[model samples]
Target chain A: MKSEARKPFSKDIIHIENIDQVCNDIIAKLKMDVTKNLQRRGAIVGISGGIDSSVCLALSAKAFGSKNVLGIMLPEQDSSDDSRHLAEKLAATYGVSTLIEDITKALDGFGCYERRDEAILRVIPDFDKKVDKAKIEIKQNIAENIPAIFSITVIKPNGDVVSKLLPAREYLQIVASTNFKQRSRMSMLYYHAERMHYAVIGTPNKHEVEQGFFVKYGDGGADVMPIGHFYKTQVYQLAKHLGVPQEIIDRTPTTDTYTAEQSQEDFFYQMPFESMDLIWYGWENNYPAEEVGKVMGKTTKEIENIYKSFERKRKTTEYLRMKPIF
Target chain B: MKSKNDVKTEIKKYILEASLSDVKDVEDDALIFENGLLDSMGLLFLIEFLGETFEVEVNDDELNPKNFESINNIVSFVNNKLSVKV
Candidate 1:
């Protein structure tokens, strides 16, 4: 068989050269998808003050008109105050009407906290929910090409910290209970969307959508996802092109679901978005791992390991991307 | 220290219990994860079992999948760690 020539792999491969054109294309698609396909009057976006949501809100405003766009800030007890503040600033910048819905009470009613604490206590017998903050993180690096081992960290009121490997059962329970936060927010978004006859705009980027980084039927539920095609790095590019606030653009992406303050990198993704975007692009395009490693300043073995990790994640989370069974 | 046969027997037993797979179908060289025997969580449980049962420390750096992809590889990894401790 004849050989097929491969495109040269480099860090610049993921860069969006014409960001304006890209943004305009996304806006055009969003307009058609919402107005014609979904039969929605406007767009409703849940703004978290993060780059992805901020960019999505900006796109929605441009596509559906600022007055027609509604930005909802869903803050729970564990959410950082900066998220709400940034979200408010983003809405104001776009001249969009905004609503603040605190889901703490809803989560509390569902026993979200109680159920999570019960599981945490299974790993840490003395874990106190009221006086302690907690977050779960992967202990091993993804480059190891082994199964991820998750450990939960608890911070005491006095600043003492404790961490322990979470068993499978406790880990599942904690994650299931915490997922109520996302599903609740999704329900609230749909409520507002239905009330206003607007499409709910999802904020996940290509990585989150393809890698199954989002909660199924929770944050994953949406009428339209304008930025789902862009990588995390490309999302930042769109944010910059849309004149998103420098502060929000510079802010590190976070899970924002835990009280203990965790970055998306530490919780998942395992590498900086810049490197991850390039590596994923190269892997997806079937470039030799050596070529990708050379550009990313990593060894060929490391690149191969990352490829394996990505494959495993895609396989495991395949069900999340599936549609409801007939 | 336990002999190689004893170490393999214990590891095989734990793999069977953790995976809940039939013993007759599982071979020494069978791929533990690829064959739907153990999952990510099952791997962690096996690591815990190795540490407690054999007093062998499995460091984060030593977590390469090649070292634990199959029952044979896991036996070799555990034996190497046990030898290092001595």
Candidate 2:
């Protein structure tokens, strides 16, 4: 807390000299801090088989050796096959001992927590039963009581049926849930890092920090992100230089935010990355709205509207700047 | 063409194949995680990728954030591994 005294605003202004020095200087100083602060604590980072993490892990394994890093795959049942494949392949490649725990049950385990929660999950099972010849659609909204040992289901009278109320694979809480996965991995990484006096590292890229694309107190929670300063595209170049998998580099990047396979960009901006990246740069560089129109082939008014939409984002980016120094 | 640096360079080539992205000009210091560039699992997979590509190992305890912040950091990390007494 004492070290975090200065709260610098997000820089739309990129200094060439700072850029050159920051990457090395930041990593060296930060690594020393991570290694020294936690003495034996090592690092935990999840690799979703995407560009950023690939870049991050390459560095982590290099810093602490593959023997010290912990790679965990916490995925929901609806997770894409590529998700599992990428995690498994990446882990195998690094010689880092790995663990794959399917948390779909944990998510569904929400029903086991509370009586009302169970009742909410106590929807009409797909079972058919005929009782007393009174065909009341009682199975529609059946309520269930949780008693540790078992769930007691009570049929509702004429209640509207809960139609496929499965937990959202990736709701707004998807980002939060994803962050939870990272935090959970950290929980395990630190356990070993501390036991062995290894340091824990975080994985973040440059664009996200500048635009404030993460959930505050969620993914934002970390010991430190070694790759937090690198841009999204730069991470790819870095990853290539680091020798990640060919499959990973070619895939359309996705957090698999939903069962529908929506990516992070889609989940966050509801737009394709190509378009978003273009607009993001123009907005940050103070590219005139009219100029944007020319490049994007949109009318000036449309570009201005787009600019206005990002105006709030630019201001909000300040909120995600350096942690307060107090 | 057939040296430790070659292997390291090859490993770099594989790692760069990843598909994550950011909204801004993909420069350094843009917050990969914050920008939705990579998630926890993606980070894990990259660890696997490195094992396969570079034949280096990342133990459970050494996955800290400092070493993987950027390309330069990653290169430094790999250099350490290449130099480590196997």
Best candidate, lDDT? 1
In model 1, which regions exceed 4 Å deviation?
A: A1-6, B1-38, B42-67, B76-86
**Candidates' lDDT values, in order?**
0.88, 0.52
Interface C-alpha RMSD, model 2? 17.9
Candidate 2 lDDT, tens digit per residue, A101-148? Answer: 665565554421132222333333432222100111111110111000
In candidate 1 the C-alpha lDDT for residue A186 amounts to 98
Per-structure clash totals for the candidates: 0, 94
Candidate 2 CAPRI category: incorrect
Per-residue lDDT of model 1, residues A100-185, tens digit only: 99999999999999999999998888888888999999868777757676889999999999888776678889999999999999
lDDT of 1: 0.88
Model number with the top TM-score? 1
RMSD of each: 3.3, 24.9
